[model samples]
Target: MKLLVVFALTLAYASASVLHGFNSLEDDTNVGIIHGHNAAPGQFPYQVQLISPEGLQCGGSLISHRWILTAASCTEHFDNVTVHLGSIRRSAPRVTYIVSKKDIIIHEDFNRYTVSADISLIRIPYVKYSIHIKAVKLPKIKRSYPSYDGCNANITGWGRTSFDSTHEPEILQYAKVGIISIKDCKKKFGKLGKYIWPSLICASIVSAETWEGDTGIPLVELRSSVQIGISSVDSPKPELEYPAIFTRVTSYLKWIKRHTKLPL
Candidate 1:
């Protein structure tokens, strides 16, 4: 199974490339949620759609009025991004912001090949909080990584609903997933299990699966509504039943605080 890191971006020279080991899917048929449903207006206020200059898309979460947390792979190769927020429909957002490369901060140790240290932060012009636009709570900073095994979580994005389709939904899509231990997740990946590290978290596919463009979306605990992960990479083959991996948010709390300078 090919592990797709998701998102396609065009370089400054106008050459297109997928993140990490990703390859573009051929089909262009429009698809909706995968074993999920359309999110209601303001249901996922923290959710944001990140669009590169060349039109490639990825997902991100608003952690503060001026800060968006996303996958490093989404912004590592590029500096500028168009962020859409406060709307369920991608076409008509309540607010839009353009962030320059100077405000985009990727992890210093980010590795595109191994997809390690896959988290990033993008700062936008400060905006007032509203019902349709709000920050998601993050896990508390601690010396040790927090575990949420078997906990219910939700992921939202406009990514392709299936592996074969390249189409992304116009409306925001969300799915309920269950968190699993890294040990169990490693067993599912088999030979690829070595890449499963403590800094990352895994979630069972359940009836739904994440596809390209879902990268950088938040994985929020259902009980407390606290974000715990950022969408990282996953196998495109659903038949393998590989658990989706995400950059554990708890593991980077200090990094975030240092960069964003926000009090937890």
Candidate 2:
């Protein structure tokens, strides 16, 4: 099945990095553009947790006052979830938090294979809470698509230090890289003969690598920082000295608006 293929490929990409044991992004310099304070500096900004029937501690992005975007795979089914806010260092106890919430929205046509539409938004039913967190802006919806050569793009993840190597990082980790042409990346990966969708963006560094646990991470653009691309899947070819793939946020604004419900 297409769904199974997508899920399997993604699992491979996330598992290649050892530090995370299972969930990891295969490269080290997972890229992004910070809209707020630097994440590594502490980032209680939105204390993110991934909870599923198996366990908790998935991955998420601190995007807005009441929303944290993350992998739809990690949120499809949940018992209880929480989001922590407004601390540079999540290790501190003075952070803000919201518990006993559910996944408020998810992309409909989300294909787990290409990792397209992997984005999801979680909302705290109640407003007043802990940390000084504000909503990170969403990208403007467009009937048009732009190339990476002219757009700002990057990805972020709080995954482990190494691929399947050790414990997950104590603090969130982020990196910055630009989006490249999917045609170039697939061609380099020797898969151009295959399928690279219009929704996917390719990225790489001439001299570095990305790792696991970084899947579902945000690949951001500098112009607005709000114009984001999400890293939903990765390819594992020897050609990828440094390779990355992301889901373009601007392309999905319509889906986001449809799913998000504001207070009455």
Best by lDDT: 1
Task: Tell me which residue pairs clash in candidate 1.
Answer: none
Estimate the overall C-alpha local distance difference test score of candidate 1.
Answer: 0.78
TM-score of candidate 2 versus the correct structure, residues matched by position:
0.71
Error of 1 at 24 (Å): 20
The alpha-carbon lDDT assigned to residue 108 of candidate 1 equals 95
Q: Which lDDT tens digits does candidate 1 get at residues 83-155? A: 9999999899988998999999999987655647888999999977899999999977766755999899998
lDDT for model 2, on a 0 to 1 scale? 0.50
Over 4 Å off in model 1, which ranges?
A: 1-30
How many clashes in each structure?
0, 47
> What lDDT would each prediction earn against the true structure?
0.78, 0.50
